[model samples]
Target: MCEEATRRQVGICLLCGLPGAGKSTLGRSFSATILRQRFAVITYDKIITAEAFHLALQDELDQSREIPPSSALLKTQETSQWKQHRQYLLEYLEHLIVALLNSSELRPPEGKCDGTWYRFVDCLEEQGLISSAGSSTEKGTHSVIIPENDEVCLVLDDNFYYQSMRYEVYQLARKYSLGFCQIYLHCPVESCVLRNKGRPVSIAEDTIRLMDKKIQKPNPEKNSWEQNSLVLDSSQLIKADDHRIVKLVNQAMANPLRPLQENLEIKEKDRAITAASILHQADQSIRRCISETMRRVKGTASAHEMKVAAQELQSAKSQFLEDLRERLCEKGIQPMTACNATTIVSLFKEQTDHIVQPFLATEQSCCLEPNLDCNDRASGIS
Candidate 1:
């Protein structure tokens, strides 16, 4: 069908990485390169920024009523409002993308205008974000129309890892029969932290630390999606004179379907690994907690407390065994002998030292700092 063929011609490329990982920069460069060959590019960041700007303006308008009239207050209010307005604009752009994905009939609003692009500016002006429709329409009138016969290459330079958005992107690509490729810009945590320090927009250190912790832990559910990924070490590129990012981009563009298929497989594996790791980690934590309780209860421990601790430990042991069995089954590892709870617990215990060592070290580190702080702070307070 003509409709199916049109959908097949649409291509989407996703650039994903931590903030300041060069996702936007690489996306822009790739867009420019592709544009030279006469391809259309649509960036998620540009759309989101426009929405953020509009939301900022609305926020300002809401605050203006509460503040007494003063030059400083007025200026501050105006700035806040402008920021809100920018957010709204970005949101509108997001909505536009969603609309386009949902219906083949949609086109960029600015592209639809037949008169001078100034007509598009007038439309935005009617929304009241801009003071006057500037005569020089060169700045704000850039728009692209999806042609009936032309192939479109869409470059998304935004955080596509968010569950809802990622799913939307995936579904859109499939629905449109678009070839999709995701380029993951992998950066070292230390390097990312250093880069964030110099940037105006930065994720907080604590947030980054939490992200690091999450990254280090494996989740079985995530294995299903990890198969479809290509990782590029941005940290290595940061030191190079001329990074071969373009080469990678070209390779991705050349074989989009292969990478997408591979990504799907990788995702499955990642999910299985992650699920196994979670079960293991949770069991270790539970055991450690029970051990500590046992120590505290040494001589005068209540019967109820001892019973609860034992129950907790038993629950963790049971769950860990269950998870391990599930993983073995998933991997097609048939048990020659039946795996009972006792056998499973004994098997896990044999591997406990290796699994629990890192956790023990982490626990020690956590306790060391807390003890030090308590002693010093308590002394000072007294």
Candidate 2:
């Protein structure tokens, strides 16, 4: 499949972090740089935002105007929104690319997307035919139909504070079998709050405080989505050497994919060994119990006594040994082995105590029931 001529190689880069973490800036720069090298670029947030804007306008018009909005009107509005959104997204993306190119982010300089292609997309967006500077698609969707052989790189920039959204993204990526890397920008809480101070739509300080108290402060461990992330400190970016950020990005991109293979193999081996050990132990315990019971029956003096002794022994085994076995299985150990090792050992210990002190007083005084004394023969004896 990788070698198929018709298959286009697509790369997705996810820029995730707290608000004002430079995700938008960095993503724009990266996309622009890649486009300049003669490659197709897509920005998910920009496209979605355009679609949202279009829908907002459509809804507004639908409410105010008496004429029912045509499918074409709706389509045009969506197209217009996406087109504008993509244009802005691409412009910002170019800014990011320029930064990366000037800095040391990409080493040995990979292939570049020529200016001709980007200029063409710009022209299409300007003409309103494409409705999106990035890619053109049918109404109600972000995907743009392209030639089968087009090589495309997509940059996804969005707020990912919610665990559910992150998981949804993960599932989407897996379903499509997309190759992508996660880039997370870290910023101080104060910095994040300060960056949003003068924005048209600003998050409240109290809300930020609540987020810190309820969301960020509680989890010390990174979630499943953050496991494969490339974390960079945005605070240090301005003061640190330019080469540091470049090196960090390069290192993340260069990480080997072989680790996943090794991890799977190790897990499989561990499971097999655990299963075998538990099964073996259970078998041994069962055999030992049978042998001991047979020996006891042979030494019993009368048929009636033998029957009672057998019943008591069976009851004890069932109560303690069987229960222990069940517990071991529940704990993920082999049921038989766990029961035999633990229950058999305990039972053996109890039996040995009885044998070692056969002459000791077998009865003791009871406190609960006046009619049921421990010395009563009806209470049963060893």
Candidate 3:
């Protein structure tokens, strides 16, 4: 589905580079270089504060952990929360984009909308997105004013060092139905580390080295966003008028990208994921049972009474073991091997096996509760 837009110039510019690679500089200067592009800049550095980010991540994790058992439960929980978070963030970004598009049609009071353009910048500023440096004058007053252009753009600045980072921006654009492209600023690691040193709050040399290792250069062959992307050699000066950049910008203006989301497709995927999770949890549960049995066996310390009781408990659960295999096969899961299933079933029965041991030779009944106080009989304390 294509996002509805009234202006031709509306799109997203994602500026990605290492620390000290001039991302901020490019973001600040992007609009001025284009003749008719009205633009705003959103620096990721400001939007994601360390404390806020950590707290947010913790909340996502906590919420995810509440999900019921399934395959890769922890991993699935994390993935679900992240997708939800991205969708929410996309909604938030759409509000700003809508406000800007509305502002483009601004006129005098008689023809005016409910509020003025100030509300637009004010709302964004509160969200930690500042207007581009040159866009403002007289102490941040005129930052939101545009040059009466037919279209406007928003530029995102960040150390988009990973392909996943860029992918998020691409997904956002698709969701909003906007034209989107990335400008990959490539610089030598040595140059970036040296550049980082001059910053007010410098990054450690080691951190820069590690970040360099993690950086993923775009490949149009593997990523659709890269097809329209530009690679700027930030190791040297690149002009806005550079042929490659101009071509990309003009192409976007002429034909902005549309979104691709198939709800039906996703619904089917979710079902499969749910099934996998259920099966995975069931499998893990079996292993846990085996481990618990092993613990019980070791805890016995070779007590003769406990061993006899354990054997009795193991015998009592024979029917339960038979049913477990049938249940797993119904769900298309691999039926447990005879040896493996027996090993797992042995654990739960081990504690029960000793119920008769304490009574033996003392006229105690063999029929005792499976969950009776094991400590009174065979936890092997004696």
Better of 1 and 2 by lDDT: 1
Compose the digit string of candidate 1's lDDT tens values, residues 1-382.
6643333244566666665577755654543353312233444433334434333333333342354466445466556654443344333444334433433322334433333223333433433323333323433332223344444455666544344445556555554344555667778778877877886655566445444433322122574433344567777543111235444334434443432345767766876676565455545544654465345444544567557655655665676557664665466432222122224334434433333333332332221011222323212101
Best candidate according to TM-score = 3
State the lDDT of candidate 2 residue by residue for 165-250, as single tens digits. 45554544443344445666777878878876865556556455444433331121655434555567876443212354344434
Error of 3 at 179 (Å): 0.9
Which candidate would rank higher by lDDT, 1 or 3? 3
lDDT of each: 0.46, 0.45, 0.56
User: What is the TM-score of candidate 3?
Assistant: 0.49
Tens-place lDDT per residue, model 3, 170-269, is 7766765677877889989899888888877566676567667667878899876778888888987665556776677667656676777569888667
> What are the per-model C-alpha RMSD values against the true structure?
19.7, 17.2, 15.9
TM-score, every prediction: 0.39, 0.38, 0.49
Cα RMSD of predicted structure 1: 19.7
Give Cα distance to truth, residue 32, candidate 3, Å: 2.7
